[model samples]
Target: MHILFLHSNYPAQFGEIAANLVAQHGDRCTFVNERVSGDQQGVKCVTYRPASGATKQTHFCAATFENQIWRSHAAAESVAQLFRSNGALAHDRPDLIVAHSGFVSALFLKEVLPEVPVVGYFEYFYHRYNSDFDFRSDLPPQSELSAMRLQARNAMLLLDLHHCEAGYCPTDFQREQIPAEYQPKLQTIFDGINTDFWKRDASLSESHATQRMVAGVTIQPYEKVVTYVSRGFESMRGSDQFLKVADQVCKKRSDVRVIVVGEDRIAYGGDARFTDGKTFRQWVIDNNDLDLSRIHFVGRVSREELIRVFSVSDAHLYWTVPFVLSWSMLNAMSCSCPVIASNTAPVQEMVRNGQNGLLVDFFDIERWVECVLQTLESPPETQRMGSNARQTIEQNYCLTSCLDKMRSLYQNVRMR
Candidate 1:
């Protein structure tokens, strides 16, 4: 079988699936994206660039939609050129196409490969109210123009939703956000975690405390470690709340240390608007009375180093609004790290309070501090929760199980 994968970034949601197909099933795979920067062994890589994007004069609400249309046109032309280079042969065409729906990369593919079945990976469907935009009360009220832009953002997504033969959402929380008419065509399947690589190293915890160091940060013999991971330090992931909680916990307990992993930028949300000419990380530091010496901001580290960090942590803090769940949280769980997460819809789907891990209301900073302290003081309970956390991932979100489902979906869609 020949499969063609499409996404704005290479080897994102499609990486493991493509690799599995080639290594296990002896399938030929090709990946097309705007940027190709990863190890593409056993797969062909193609890159495309938009001819033009929306100009400054373009209406604010339609700017995103305009850029997506240009991207769709560019991607379609790239695939057409690939076929022409192959002498336009029927067998050269792929048996199926898997695309990420957010960028509408496959919107115009039907014109070139009309008979091929395309499966869309729908990540999120935005809403002006009752979603990420309005979830935080600290932010200013949404303007009419902002609401219009949120609605316009879905224009291309809606187009791809109807154009594809089938689609999938990484979680049920994300799937339920789509319009009711299109829900039946979508499946909820998580981009699985590689438990084999992410599992905890028991030796790390038993090592001499003075010799314990990960990603250049050392752990003292008398201190307890708390870990927080995200792609960015932004309010969408509750970076501010986490810092505030960290300050209180550190103040209450002299033996606690915090390790934050991620860059100091806003990955989501309009947090910059409130930062007053400062990065959100700096803004939070300016406003809070935090213990700078105790908190270690290790920007980003390799996966192996991250696993080591999780192995030594007494608690892992994860907080978010009602938005797309972060893979870092699941990875920590896979490492058997005791997680204390926000009680939002997406987090609730994975964490069962007091069973697998603990849950706290997003705004309840006191409760967050309490949970951290609880994990540190009760070593037996914390270890039990960590063990259960690993079991949860192996049962539902393991990489092998998810790849099997993906292969089944591909075969089913092709038959149709």
Candidate 2:
């Protein structure tokens, strides 16, 4: 079987699946992406670039959709070039195309290879309210133009959903955001975690673990380490609340250390609404009375370093509004860290209160502080919860199970 994978960023969420298929089936798998960073182990990668650039004159509302169309056109042209038998390099057509939905690459592929089945990765469906933008109370008020742009961004998403044979969302909470009629064609499959690599290391001890430290802060086994990770220090992930509670915790406890892993930039939503010219991290520092020495803001670390932090942490703090889930939370769970997460749809889907981990209200800084204190105070209970958290990931969100589901989806679409 010949499978083609499409993503604007090379191997976005489809990396594991694409690599697995290539390993199992050898040269039958190919990846077409907008990036040509390097080579993969057993897959052929073809790169594409937008034929036209977004001009300054492009209307703000239509700019996003126009850029998506440019990506679709460029990817379609690259795929067409591969099929030209007269070209220097000719490749056979794919049996199936798997792509990220919002880019509209798969939609254009349908026009080129009309008979082939395309599986779209439906990550999220934007909305004017009740979505990422309005989930937080701290965000600045939205304008009519901003709301219109948000609606306009979904133009390609709706079209992709209509044309694709099947779509997969990482969580059912996300799948519910799509139109009800399209829900049947969508399946829930998590972007699974590698439990073997992320598991707790029993051999790691205070004496030996000092060799590798997070941002040069050596964590002693006697001190309780609390960790918070996100793609960025932004409002959607509740970075503000986390920092406020971190300040509170630091003032109350002497033996606790806070390690935050993320950049100061905003990954989602508007910028820091309170500050005139400050990053979110800078704003948090300027407004709050936090102990600079107790908190370590390690911008971002490698995968191995993250696993190390998760392994040694006594408690992991994951706060977010009712938005898309972060893989950082799941990865922490997989590493058996006692997680204190916000009670949102995505977090609630994976974490059960008093079972695997503890959940708290997103806005309640007191409850968040209490939960972290509880985890730090109770050693046996924290270890038990960590054990349960690892078990949860192993049972439901492991790599093997998710890949099996993906393969089944592929077969179902191919047979149809």
Candidate 3:
């Protein structure tokens, strides 16, 4: 079977699955993307550039919608140019097309190839009230204009839902955001982690006998190491809360050190301006009573380094609004790191409070600090939770199991 994968930024959610299919099926699989950071072996990469973004002529509310329209047209035209001549298939057309739903790349694919089925990756559906917009208290006040824009953002996704053969989301909580009428068509299948690469390293503790320096800070194996990671230090990921909790932990325990991994910028929930003329990171540091000496902000590191960090961490902190789940949290769990996560929808699905990991209310700073300190104080309990965390990933969210389920889903879609 000829399978075609699509994502504006190539090799994202589809990277592992596409690469696996190419290795197993050889030249039978191809990937169509807008751009790729690195090349993938055993797969054909086709690049397509969408038209420029919105301009002054575009209506304010419709600007977001118009950008998607451009993407839809550009992707459709690019795919056609590659495989068509005189409005006919000039090369072997795809038997099945799997695409990310946010970009509208597959919006026109059905119009181009009426027979081939398209399976969409449904990551998130926006809502004004019980969603990311309202999940956090630190965010700026919402307005009617912002609400309208948020509503318009879903124009493309709604279109894809109606046109695509089937759809899948990474978590059940994310799948719930979609309209009830469309829920039957969407299934939950996490973009799994590579267990072999992320598994706990038995030699990590023994190899580093003396004090070790990570991100320019010295940390002895005997010291309590609490770690937090996100793509950016933003409100959506609960960076603010993490900093506060770190302050509390530092005051109680002098041996504890907090390692933060992420850039100091806003990636989600829009820009939040501080009265002190400091970035969110700086604002947190200045306002909180944290010991600057114990906090280490390490910008983005490589995947290998990330796994190693997770392996050595005493407790991993992960918090986010009720949105798409972070893959880093799963990787931390796969590395047998005890996780203290927010009691949100996406996290609750994976972390059973007091089971694999402890969950605290997102805004409950005292409880968050207590959980982290408890995990640090009790080595035996922490070890048990860490073991259970790894088991959770191995059984459900590992690459091997997720890929098998993906292949079966694709076959079912194709058969229909």
Candidate 4:
């Protein structure tokens, strides 16, 4: 089979699945993106750049939609070139096209390959209230323009939803965010975790007395490690709340050390505007009286080092607003790390409170500290939750199972 994958970024959500198809199924794959870097074996890369984007004169509400249209136009032209005499279509064309719906890259693909079945990977649907936009009450109240922009942001997504033959969301929580009329067109399928690589290392148990090193940080035999991973230090992931909880926990328990992973920049928007010329990390540190020595901010480490961090973790802390779920939480759980995550819709879908892992209200710093302490003070119960966490991933979110489901989706769509 031949598959053409489309995204603004190269080898993103489709990377592992594309590689799997090439290695195991002997399928040929081609990826189209605006910025193409990195190499994936048995897969071809094509680049596209927009001729122009929204200008300063453009209305704020329509600026995002305008940029998306330009992206769609650019992506369409790139794909059209692939079908020319000097391109891959000189002999054969793709059997199917799978695209990330975030940027609407596949919006105009039908103009290039009208007969091909296009599958959209819908990540999230924006809402003015009861979603990420309005979830943070601590931040300043959103203006009417913010609500208008939020509605306009979905223009391209709605078009792509109607254009594609089929679509999928990583979780049911994400799928439910879309318009009710289009709900039937989408299915839930996670971009699975590699449980084999993330499985527990029995040697790193808290009962061991040996000192260990992870990502250049030394872990003493008597110390307890609490792990937190995020793409950025932003309010979307509750980085500030995590720090507050960590500070109180460290104050109460001298043996506890917090290992934070990720960069200092805000990956998601809206938090930076309120930070008064300082990065969100610096702003949080400036306002709060946090114990800097006890918390180690080890900026972004490799997967191997991350696994080591999780393996030694007494409790993995994950907190987020009601938004798209972070893969790090699942990865930590896959490593058999006892997790204490936000009791939000997305986290609740994966974690059964007190069964697989503990859950606390997102705003309750005391509850978060209590949960973290519970994991540290009671080793046997924590170990049981860790074991169940790994079981949850293996049964529902293993890479093999998800790949099979993806393949089934492809075949079914092709038959339409």
Candidate 5:
């Protein structure tokens, strides 16, 4: 089948799925993207770079926002114009259209080729808004600014949802957010990790040997490293809470270390340099007078580096409010890295709490600290949980299984 895939960023969640299909079925896949990032496992990818510039979140200006969302439509129109200019699409329309709803491409693709079956990657649907904005009742009266920002963002999905033939959500939690009326077309697919690259069998001592040596000493295996991975240290991620609890944990125990991996900008409510507030990163840096030396931040690293981080850690630290859990958690599981995630929908499903990994109260700093401390106190139990974590991924979320689901779903959608 000649499949046309649309995503704002090529080879993201949709890119992996698209690449998987081409490798397994020899399907010719054309990917229209906002930016050209990189090549993939195995796929024929054709990119459509919009003549317009990248989307910017400037001071509230109606004209600027419209230009950003509609850029993809303008670009897809160019795709149709290019086809008409060459009589290409007219000769052979795509068998199916896979789109990502968070982007503008799906709506424009619908306009360009009225007959193509359009399936979308339904990343999110935010009708209720970011409650985290109001979550802090203690810090004076609340402002609706964040909620307003989220509501304004919700308007972007309306066109994409109405035009889709089907929607694929990476997690059941994400799927649940869509309205019941739209749920008929929703399908759940596990966003997975490449187990081959992630799965490592080195002993604890061996794994500890390669860990980042700060001031030239193997981060001792005796130290219980609770690691958190993400794109930043931000509010939604509860990075601040993680760090705050790390402070609490540090005072209570000497053998514990808090390691944060991933960039901190746009993480702890934007980077410290630009954003006025002391983001969790800056907070950690400021509070180094305490046992804060144990609180460590590992700068952003590549995928292979992340696997190594996951492999050596005793626990995968996670603190999310409404944000989606990072792929790092799945990679951690593949590496048999036990996770201590917030009890949110997707996380609740992933972690069986004391089974594969532990789940803590999202906002309860004391409880979160206790859970982290528990893992350190009980090394044997933690190791057993880590083993089970890997087993769970092997059974349900391995790369091969995800590919199988993708190809099967594509066939089913195409057959219709």
Candidate 6:
């Protein structure tokens, strides 16, 4: 079978699956992307320029509106042109065309190859009303929810279905968010983790490391670190709640340190001003009166450094409401860092309270603090629970298992 993998950023969700597929069926898989960060071994990758242009506007005035509209349209056209010219195939065509599109890229692909079956990974569908608006305090208030969502949904890049084959989501919660009519076109498959790499057995010694640090945070094995990894300390990520609980947790344990991974604001919108001046991390620390000495706001730590932190930390802390589980949480769990997460749908799927790890209510700030404290206080139980987490990941959520499921799904989709 000839497979064409499409993602705006190559190997984003397909990292493990892509490798496994290419290894199993060499020369049968080809990938095309605008943003290929690093090369992948077997998959033929064609590089294309990312088409994005906009005039500088002091504010998002009407003058900037036309420029952005033109840019988005031009980006779609550029992608279409690349697909037709560079990507060559035989009578086999593509048995499956998989894309992780959400930024108008997929729309562009449809414009070019309307007959090809394009599958999208639906990451998010926003209902920009009620909590949704406040859910993103970092973002300036949108003038109109429906109008803005129509624009933002275009950013989802999932609109290819009108001309493409199907769609996929990493979580059921995510899939359900799509319009009920669209849900029929969606399939839920988790992008699993590689247990071998993420396992608790990663050497605590820094000599094995390639001298890389996560977001520049060094990993010293002996420190009593409690880590939180996210794109940022934003509302959706429960950053405010984490701060509240952290402040309370620190009141009792002075030795424990909190380290959060991922970008602050510069990585998100390129400017912190978009995220309300201080960013969520800064806002939390300032308003909560957190001691920076105990709380280290490590922005955009590298994956290697993150592993190092997990290798040595007392516990891994992740809290989210109704969203898919963060890849960092799985890595933390695979590393045998006992996870303490909110008892939301996605988290409940991973953490089986007092089994592999612990779960707390999303809004219950006190329980969040208690679980973290209790996990650290009980060393033996903590280690045992951590072991359980690793074992669970190895058996079910491992990369190999996920690949098997992915291949089967592709075959099934093609056969249909």
Best by TM-score: 1
Model 6 local distance difference test score: 0.66
Over all chains combined, what TM-score does candidate 2 have? 0.94
Please estimate how well model 1 matches the true structure, expressed as its whole-model Cα lDDT.
Answer: 0.90
lDDT of 1 at 131: 87
Q: Write the per-residue lDDT of candidate 4 for residues 8-52, one digit (tens) a residue.
A: 986678888888889988988888888874467878888889999
Quick one: RMSD of model 3? 2.2
- What is the per-residue lDDT of model 3 for residues 108-186, given as tens digits with 9 covering 90 to 100? 8777777889998898899999888877656566677878889988888898889888989999988989999999998
**TM-score, every prediction:** 0.97, 0.94, 0.94, 0.96, 0.87, 0.81
lDDT of 6 by residue, 80-139 (tens): 554455565535456667776554345555556556666677776655443333434444
Where model 6 places Cα greater than 4 Å from the true spot, the runs are 37-39, 50-89, 129-158, 202-223, 266-276
Assess the local accuracy of residue 278 in candidate 6 as a C-alpha lDDT between 0 and 100: 72
For every candidate structure, what is the RMSD over all alpha carbons to the true structure, in angstroms?
1.3, 2.1, 2.2, 1.6, 3.5, 4.8
- RMSD in angstroms, candidate 6? 4.8
Which lDDT tens digits does candidate 1 get at residues 99-177?
9987746979999899999999999999877789999888666677888899999998998899899989999999999
Q: Write the per-residue lDDT of candidate 2 for residues 1-416, one digit (tens) a residue.
A: 77888888866787767887677645376788888644686677888889895689998889988998999989998887877546533237787898897665587887778888999889888878777777775657766787888998888999999988898999998999999999999999998887878887665523443544655678765677889999998888889889888888887888888998888798877665555778877887787776768889888888888887887788999987767888899999998999999988889999999999999999999998898998899989998999999999999999888888988888789889
- TM-score order of candidates, top first: 1, 4, 2, 3, 5, 6
Candidate 2 Cα errors over 4 Å, as ranges: 25-27, 86-91, 205-212, 272-274
Q: What TM-score does model 1 achieve against the real structure?
A: 0.97
Highest lDDT among the candidates is held by which one?
1
Clash number for each model: 0, 0, 0, 0, 4, 8
lDDT of 5 by residue, 1-416 (tens): 87877776767876776776678778777776767633556554556555664345554423334654666765577558645665574546678888776645567666778777877777777654444444433333334554455566655565667777777888888887877888888889876677888885475425554444531224774676778888877666776677777788888988777777877566533234333576656765575444568776777887766666666677778877654567778888889887888887677878898899998888888898788888878878988999999999999888889878876777788888
